[model samples]
Every structure is written in structure tokens, then in C-alpha cells.
Target chain A: MKATILYEGKHQWTVFGRDPDKPEKIIDTNQYLVSTPSRALLIDPGGIEIFSSMLAATLHHVSVDQITDLFASHQDPDIISSLGLWDQVLPNARLHSPWLWESFIRHFGLNNIEYVPLPDDGGTIDLGDLSLQLVPAHYLHSSGNFNIYDPQAKILFSGDVGAALEADGAPMFVDDFDEHIPKMKMFHQRWMPSNRAKNDWVSRVRRLDVDILAPQHGRLYRGADVKRFLDWFEALEVGVGV
Target chain B: MARIKDERLAEGEVLVSVTVIAAELSEVMKIAKEISIGAKNAKAIAARAGDKARGFQPITNFIDDMARHTLTMVRQIDQEALSVSRICSQEIRTNDAKRRMHDVIRRVEHPSLLKSFQGVVTDIDARLIALRREFDKRLDHLAELLDSINSDMRAATAISSSCRVEASRAEEFREGLGVVADNLEQAVEVIKKHVKECSSRLQHAQRLKQAIYKK
Candidate 1:
């Protein structure tokens, strides 16, 4: 598993992904950790198959008890299927997820953790010292989806919105917007079912002062490439397979 | 002395075996109900025969009692088997969680961070231990229930043999009474077969649970 420090300030944002030791056939995923001094929040903790690797990688930064909160962008297995295992370890932790997914997400084994349901309009996750905004991105893929935006860090944890289906060991950040289009095109077209929802998300994200557009899969879009992705995605016709 | 092989069974296997026990018990319950109905029919025939089937009347009463007892025991065993399945599922989840946490703790190179995991790991370890204990206790209870069913089947076999002896004295209704005896014996045999299979599954699941927790 690779851990990259995406932002370093009073609080830190570290992305853990690109696990070389991941078992064959399972999709690779990127898990984000936002660590304050006394509390930490884990975002989109991956499936059950990668729980050990995710937990081991997380220990490099914040200890187990320090992980006070968990956030699931939606109820996708690749996103939070490890909730049962996490429920065992982080007994006191609160899980912040879409209100619509509260009952569905509990099916993933969430007995001990408190489920702090986020309304459809989205809400804020108060990490004691820092507060992160949960931006709604409904119908972009999942009916009840959200993206975590850090205004101070100028970064958007876009869940599956900016996700691309790339080959294994792909670069962490999009270096060439034109070349990356093919990797992302098929995934967006097939997975993102609503063009209206895609345009809505694009317009909403455009208003945010985002320097980094982090996704849960493949590479992230940063700086000029972030704008390039928005332009390309806004123009592309999605949900074509229907 | 020969040593027992250290066999590893997945939690799903144990759960499936326990669930199969319930299904087998359900079959036993159906057979028991048939036995009860057969006993009622035998009683009716004995009443029609009057003094000719006088001795068979007591035997019919005994068969009815056995069938009722078997039905009650099967219901109890079914409930216990389902409980065992639930406990097994919970124990497997807790065990897997504990194993993953241990892996994380082992990989933590930083001493202070490792120390921070201690409290939570201890808490999880305690939960795993409690679940294992509950699982073992419930499994033992299920074994006892299966044992009681086995004991009831033994009594049933004896009553079935007695039923045959009384059937020969029925005179003109000899063939009718004889058929009733045969049906009772056959029902007992079917129940015995299902009970044996259920007991075998329970034992296998118990051995697997012991082997898993022994480590």
C-alpha cells in the first residue's frame, strides 16, 4: 500500500492506495485519512478483502483509537464494505454517510459504530478543530452520493465522480489530460448514469476553489488537469449503454 | 496412540452444518406427526375390534405418547440448532475482526502508535473471547438436545417392537393391525435416520469449533 501526503497544514490529509499486495481480481481503491491532533476521519474505507492492508497503512499515521469518525460516499462495497470489521475495531466511532444509505449501509455490519446520517442536501463533519463540508452529488452515479470538500485545503474528495478505470500501478495523479480521457471515458459512460446529474455536479464543483480533484479510483486530477477533466466530462455524453 | 488431525473448518461450513441439522429436524417433525396420526388410526381400529384387540389398545396409547414426545423434542432441537447457527455467525465475524486487528498491531513499527491500539485491541479481543465462549456453550446445548432426541428414538424402537407383538392377536383384523405396526416401525426408522444424520452434523460442527478455538 502507498501512502501519499496530499496536504500538510494544522490538520493533515493523507491518501492511502495503490496496494501492490492486494489479492487478484479485486478493484484497487484509494482511501483517504484526515488527521487532526486528537481525532482522525477515515473516508471511503475499502472492501473486506483489503481491510488488513487499509488498517496497517492507517496505523502509519494515526493510531486505531484516533480514528474517531468514518465517512462513506455511498453504500458501494468498494467504498465501505469493510464497515463490519471497522465496526469491531472502532466501537465508539461515528460513521457519516448518506441518510438514504443508513439502513442499507448497516447491512455491511455496523453494530457498534454510530451512524450520523447526512441529509440529501449534505452537511458538515465537525472534526473537533476542523470542519469539512459534505457536498451532495446525487445521481452522478449512486442515487445518494456525496463528496467531501475541504475549503481550507482547496481539495475535493469527489468519491466516484472523477474515478477512472486504469491499469494496475497507474500514476496517482493525472499527468496528461488528453491521454487520460480514454481511461476515464468508458467508466464515466457506463457508471455515471445521468447526464443531467453529471452536468449538475460539474457546475457545482466549478464553484469550489479546488486545487486537487481526488477520486476513489485510478488517478486524481490536479491543477490545470482538474479544469480539463470538468470541461471533458461536461461535454461527454454519459449513460450511453442504456 | 494415534493423534487426531487438526482439521480447519470455515465459519460458513459450521453455520451450514448447523442449519442442516434444523432442516433434518424439520423432517423428523413431519415423520413424528405421521406417527401421531398413525397412532390415532390404530386406536380407532382397536376400538372397532373391541375385546378382540383389547391388548392392542394399551400399545396404541404407548405409541401415541412416544410420537407426541418425539414431536416436542424435535421442536426444541430445531430451535437450539438455529441458535447455534446464529452464535457461529457472530463468533466468525468477531474472530475475523480480531485477526485483522492483530495484523495491524504487528505491522505498526512506531511504538507510540502501537500503544494507542492496545486499548481498542484489548476491547475487541475481549469481545471475541466472549463470543467464542457463547458459541461453545450454545453448541453444547444443541448436542444435548440431539442426545435427548436419540434417547427418544431408542424408546420409539422398543414401542415399535411391542406394537408388532400385539398386532398378531387382532384375529380378523390381524392384517389391518399388522399394517399399522409396520407403518409405526417404518416411521420410527425414518425418524432414527434423520436424527442420526443431525447428530453427525452436530458432532462435526462441534469438533471444528473446538479445533478453531484451541489455537
Candidate 2:
């Protein structure tokens, strides 16, 4: 697994993905960890198959006990199927997920950790020293979904909003916005599910002071490319699977 | 490496044994109900025979009581078997988590971080111990229930013998009373067969539990 440090200020943001040992069939996913001095929050901890790799990569940075909280952007397996395993390791941690997915997500066997459900309009996760906002992205793909925005780091952990189905060894960040269009276009059109929801999400994200747009899959958009993604997504007619 | 494989195999064995016990006990329950019905029919036949079968009246009541007792014991076994199965699944999960946590601990090189991981391992260890204790307690209760059923069913053969002796005196109703005795004996045999199989399965599971925990 590759670990990229997106921000290394007072509160650090690291992305773990591109596992060299991942099985051929399963989709590649990116998991982000936001850590403060005394606390850490793991976002979208991936599936059950990749748990060992995820844990080993995470342990290289923070201790198991230091992971005080977990965040699930949606109920998708690729997003949070590792919750049950995480429930076993992090005895004192709390899971922050969508309120609509509380009962549904619990089916993945959650017995140890506390479930802190996020309300429809969105909420905040306080890491003692740093606070991250849970921005609403409902129907961008899932009926109940969210994107984590770290104001301190100016990075938006977009769940599946800007995801692209790329090859195994794709670059971590988008270097060319025009060339990356084809890689992301089909995924957004088929999976986003609603044009109204897409426009709403785009408008809401444009209002935030985001420097890096880190998605759950494929490459992230940074600097000028972040604006380019918003402009392109706003005009694109999604939910084209009808 | 062989020890680890055996432990993993034992983990699955415990769950399978409890499930088989529950399924077999359900068969006992069905046959026990049939015996109760057979007892009722014999009672009616004895009443019709009146003075001729006066010796057989009390035997029918005994058959009914035995069937009822077997039913009660089998139901308790079924419930206990289900509870044990659930606890076994929980223990398996806790043990697997402990193993994985240790794997993580071994991979870490930082001395300070290793200490923090140890805290998580300590908590997992305590939980695994509690689950194992709970599982053992449940298994002991299950064994007691199985023993009670076993002892109770052993009396069926003697009761069937008494029924045969009394049925011979029924005179006109002798054929009917004999058929009732035969059905009771058949039902008891089926119940006893399943009960014995369940006992053997539970004993096997208990042995595996002891072997796994002794280490």
C-alpha cells in the first residue's frame, strides 16, 4: 500500500491506497487518515479483504489505540465493510456514519464501537484539536452519503463524488484535467444517479475553500484542477443509465 | 503451524456440533409428541375395556407422563444448544481478532507505538477470556440437560415392558392395546437414538473446547 501525506501541519492528513498485493477482482479504494496531536480519525476504512493491509499501513503512522474515531461516508461495502474488524481492534472508538444507514450498516456486525450517526444536513467531528465537517452529498450515488471536509487542511474527502475507475498503478493526484475527463466521465454519469443532486453538491463544494479534493477511488484533484472538476461536473448530465 | 490449523478447525467444529444437536433434538421433540398421542389412544382403549383391562389404565398415564417429561427436557436442550452456538461464534471472532492484533504488533518497529498497540491487545485478551468462560459455562449447562434427558429416556424400555404385560390381560381389547405398546416402544427408540447422538456430539465439542483453551 502507498501512503501519501497530503498535509503535515498541526493536524496531518494521509491517504493510503494503491495496494500492490490487493486481489485482482476487487476495486481499488483510497482510505484517508486525519490525525491531530492526541487523536486520529480513519475515513472510509475499505472492505474486509483489505483490512490487514490497511491496518499494517495505518500502524506505520499511528498506534491502534490512537485511532479514536472512524468515519463512513456511506453504506457501501467498499466504503466501510471493514467496520466489523475495526470494531474488534478499536475498543474505545466511535463510528460516525449517515443516520439513514445506522441499522443497515450494523448488519456488517458492529458490537463494540459506538455509532454516531450524522444528520441529514451534515455535522462536525471534533478530533479534540481539529474539527472536520461532514458535508452532505445525498444521492450523488447513495441516497444517504457524505463528504468529509477538513477546514484546517483545506481538503475535502469526497466519498464517491469525483471517483474514477482507473488502472492499478494510476497516479495519486490528477496532473492533467483534460486527459482525466474520460477516466471519470463514465463513472460519474452512470453512478451519480441524480443531476439535481450533482448540481447541488457541486454548488455546495464550490462555496468551500478547498485546496485538495480527495476522492475514495482513483486520482485526487488539487489546486486549479479542483475548480476544473467542479465546472466540468456542473455541466455534465449525470444519471444517464435510464 | 499444525497447532494453529487444528485450533482453527476446532473453532468451526464447536459451531457445527451445536447446530447438529439442535436439529437432532427437534426430531426427538416430534417423536415425543407422537408418543403422547399414542398414550392418549391407549387410555381410550383401556377405558372401553373397563374391568378386563383395569391393570392397563395406570400404565397409559405413565406413558403420557414420560412423553411430557422428555418433551420438556428436549426443549431445554434446544434452547441451550442455540445459546451455545451463538457464544461459540463470538469466541471465534474474538480469538481471530486477537491473532490479527498480534500480527499488527509484530509488524510495528517503533518502540513507543508498540507500547500503545499492547494496550489494545490487553483489552482483547480480557474479552477473549470472558467469552471463553461464558462458552464453557453454557456448555456445562447443556451437558447437564443432556444427562437428564438420557436418564429419563432409559426408563422407556422398562415402561414398555410393563405395557406388554398389562396388554396381555386386555382380552377383547388385547390387539389394540398391543399396537399402542408397540408404537410407544418405537417412538421411544427413535427419541433415544437421537438423544444418544446429541450427547456424543456435545461431548466432542466439550473436548475440543478444553484442548483449545488449555494452551
Candidate 3:
């Protein structure tokens, strides 16, 4: 599978289930398009107003019908409020998420799309040549949360855990871990307060040989810095998490 | 009879005039002495009364010492007055020596002849003037001293009054302590009575047990 990184400022998206070079950051949504030889997948496709222009730009190269599956990591407004909008744009796309967050999404009045309950334990969903593994991040910040890890690309799409509040202009790769670690530390302390959850996450990541750690909020971290962050995260006092 | 008649006539006329004049001078001197003695006596009485007031011992001591010194001064002034009176009377009685003395006194008293005797008279007059000035100054000083003493007495009286007030407060405090002591004693007595009653009850219980065992 081929990968193309589409970034707007510090925000980045890895396009694997769709055509490369279509990076979208509209209004409040950050969209990642992953395409295989036959089908395509869009993870956390932002709100309608935000991704509309970028979608237009993306469709210029590939058709909207190419999108076969849509994955929302959690049920927050900024994360999956655009699910209905994505359903309208790609009617055949299946909404894959944890079963726990299905009712939460129904609360948003999105009914037409098929809600595929991803397993609580780690499981894989075939997307042509690449497979998306649903890694459980239960109680990291929310009760029903998971992340997609593509072993083919060695990329882990961490939902919110390693995320920072970096602006769009920040470095896309993990080369600037010194500057980004403080932001990540602050975000973790505020959002992820449980030491047990943090340790569980660190152990999960340590098992995966990740080349890229892309979070929903910040720039992607790559290489040994990813391991360093995991080690640092595991060693931090639990109290500091909150 | 002629000699007795002559002696009586002289004694009744010239001698009587001289004696009356001397008596008048003596009366003046006596009045001066009385004034001085009255002032000295007043000081002594105040000193003695002040000394007897045990609370004002410092003030009394000071007044006693001042009174003794003042008595000595009054005595000296009385002596001086007596000397002046004696000189005036002695001069009056020596009628035979008067003509010769009058010649010397006339020269001394005469302002023109006094020029020759200027040093002596001037010295005497200056001394008298100085004495009068000193007396005036001393009177003013005494008045000021008395005023200061009065003010000090008023201050002492105020202080003594405050001390009395403080003493009353201390008495009240002591009375409060007495009440506390009485309450404590009452509590102790109550505790002792309870202990005695408990002891008697225990003894009665022991006797009842003995009777029951005997039965």
C-alpha cells in the first residue's frame, strides 16, 4: 500500500485508503484519506463545511464513490459530528466504531449509515492490501475509544493520547520531540488522568513497531522519538496525568 | 526735798520722753521679730505635719530640712534688728555726749561734708541698697518657690488619688481570688463527702455479706 501525508500547518493526515496528495483541513475537521487498489477509507473526515472544499479538491483526482469505509475514533463533536455529512457524501461507506459509542452517534440523528461495531480487544479489518487494526484505548480519556494501527505502514493513528495543541505551522514529523513533548505532556495530564490507562496504552504501543504516531490533535511523531515518548509516558507518575 | 523734787521732775519729763521713745523703737523691733518668727513657725509646723504623713515621706523630709534652715535665718535677722534698736537707744540716752556726737553726725549727715565721708556712707548706702535689692529678689524667689511647691503638692495629691484608685482595683482582684478559693474549697468538701459516703456504703455491704454468710 502506498501512503501520502497531507498536512495543513501542524496537522497531518496519512492518505492510504484514497488517492495521495489530497490533504483537507476545513473549519473544525481534519480528514485522512486511505485508498487501496479497489476501495478507499476516510478516517475522522471533518465536518461538511470544513472538508467540502478539500473534498472537492480531492475528488478532482479521485471520485467520491471511491470512499467505501469511514472510521470515527470516538463520539466527540469535533471527531465524529461530521458522520452524517460523510454518509451523504459517500452513501456506501460503513461507519466503523466501538459499539459503546453507537448510541452516542445516534444522538446526533445520523440514521442511514451502517454502524459496524468494532471489537473491544484488538482486531483487524481488511481494506484491500492494508489492514486496519482496532486497538482498544478503553478509558484513556473516554470509556469507548479506539485507534487504528496500520501494520503495513508501521503507522499508529492514536486518537487523542499523544496529541498536542500545536498550531498548523508546527513540524509534521517527530524530529521536534523536545518542543512537542511538553505540549503532549500537558494534554495527557489534562485529558488522560488514569495511570492504569496510560500504562496500558504505553505497553500497547511498545508492542507495535510504529514508524509514525499520528494523533487527532497534533503533528505526527516518527522513529525512535516515538519509543522515547512511550518510555517517558510509562515512567511518569500517575498523579501528573491529571 | 529739793533734790527729790528735782530728780522726780527730771525723771517725769526728759527721762519719761526718752523711755517712751525707746519703748516705741522696741515695739517696732518686736513687731519685726514677730513677723519673722510667725513665718518661721509656719514653716516648722508645715514641715512637722508633712513629716508625720507617712505616705508623703519624701515631701515631709524636704519640708523639715527647709524649715530648720529658715528658722536659723529668722534668728539671725532678729539679732540684727535687736542691734539696730540698741544703737538708736544708746545714742538717745547719752545727752552729755550729744553735742560732740552731734558735731560728728552733722558732718556725716550733711551732703557737702558727706562728700568727704562719701566712701563710707556711699559704701553703707550701696550695701543697704544691695540688701534691699537682695531682699526683693529673695521675696520674688520665695514666691516662685512657693508656687512651685504648691504645684508639686497638687501633682502629688493627684498621684496619691490615682494610687488609691489602683489600690481599690487590686482589692477587687483579691476579692475575686477569694471567691475562686472558696469555690475550690467547696468542691473539695463535696468530693470528700462523696468519698466518705462511698466508704460507709462499702462497709455496710461488707457487713451484710458477713450476716448472710453467718445465716
True contacts kept of each: 0.90, 0.60, 0.00
User: How do the residues B1-215 of candidate 3 rate in per-residue lDDT, one tens digit apiece?
Assistant: 11233322332332233223323333333433343343344334434544332333343343334334433433443343344333323322222122222333342323443233224234334433454344334333433432332343344344434333432334424333233223323332332343233234323323332332233
Worst 10 residues of 3 chain A by lDDT: A19-28
Shift of residue B14 alpha carbon in model 2, Å:
2.5
Candidate 2 collision pairs: none
Residue pairs clashing, model 3: A9-A168, A10-A168, A16-A34, A16-A35, A17-A34, A17-A35, A18-A34, A18-A35, A26-A50
Q: How far is candidate 2 from the true structure (C-alpha RMSD, Å)?
A: 2.3
Q: Which residue pairs clash in candidate 1?
A: none
True contacts kept of 3: 0.00
Candidate 3 lDDT over A27-93, as tens digits, reads 2224466666466677776543333334443443344556677888888776776565454445456
List per-prediction Cα lDDT, in the order shown: 0.87, 0.88, 0.52
For model 1 chain B, the run of ten residues with the poorest summed lDDT: B1-10
Q: lDDT per residue, candidate 1, B101-129, as tens digits?
A: 88776776766767777887788778878
DockQ of 2: 0.57
Give the Cα error of residue B92 in candidate 1, in Å.
1.9
Using DockQ, rank the candidates from best to worst: 1, 2, 3
Backbone clash count for every predicted candidate, in the order shown = 0, 0, 9
Tell me the deviation in Å of residue A51 in model 2: 2.2
User: What C-alpha lDDT, on a 0 to 100 scale, does residue B183 get in candidate 2?
Assistant: 87
Task: State the displacement of the C-alpha of residue B29, model 1, in Å, after optimal TM-score superposition.
Answer: 1.2
Model 1 agreement with the true structure over A1-242: per-residue lDDT tens digits? 89999999999999999988788799899999999999999999999988988988998898777999999999999999999999988889999999999999999988889999999999899999999999999987899999999999888999988888878888899988899888888888999999999999999999999999999999998999889999999999999966
